[model samples]
Target: MTAGEDISVRRKKLRYRAWHRGTKEMDLILGPYADAHTEALDEAGLDRLEALVNEEDPPLLKWVMGQEEPPENIDRGFLAEVIADHSARLAR
Candidate 1:
């Protein structure tokens, strides 16, 4: 490829890498913010958190957990709710 083409390809690769790193699947599955903030996590932690998230609206659950966003996703109310609920539950 020509020099310009090479640069474009590298830029595309870098963008993809950054996006993937920010939204890695494990971050979603493991509950990134919740995991970091929560304490005393044990065998029940994952199950409990997953259950709470499922109780939330599914699309909100996806967005908060980085799974998927709704077609017109924008507001962050769901994320805020998740963080608040998780923090409160894990505090005890």
Candidate 2:
């Protein structure tokens, strides 16, 4: 497959993993966001998202939910976009 096709496959896999997280809350939080945005993410953004998904749900949720601030390493510009997008989705 071409590079674009590989990325498409990777995005599909990530979307599936995001939706199938063990916890219902995590599923709700990450599933829709993944469905909407995972295809647009570049390789580095996909890496960051995978890392976040691998983390324990509570801490990840805390950061995303604004109950706790995300650390500097995770508080990148892409992450800001993710947070904004998630917030906007919640607002709608």
* Residue-level lDDT for 39 in candidate 2: 78
Candidate 2: the clashing residue pairs are none
lDDT per residue for candidate 2 within 35-85, as digits (tens), equals: 998877999878877877777887777877779887776645655666777
- Give the TM-score (vs. native) of candidate 2: 0.78
The 10 consecutive residues of candidate 2 with the worst lDDT sum are: 73-82
As a whole number from 0 to 100, the lDDT of residue 23 in candidate 1 is 38
Residue-wise C-alpha lDDT for candidate 1, range 26-58, written one tens digit per residue: 234335444443343343443344443433354
Model 1 regions more than 4 Å off: 22-92
Ten contiguous residues with the weakest lDDT in model 1: 14-23
- Per-model lDDT: 0.45, 0.80
What TM-score does prediction 1 earn?
Answer: 0.25
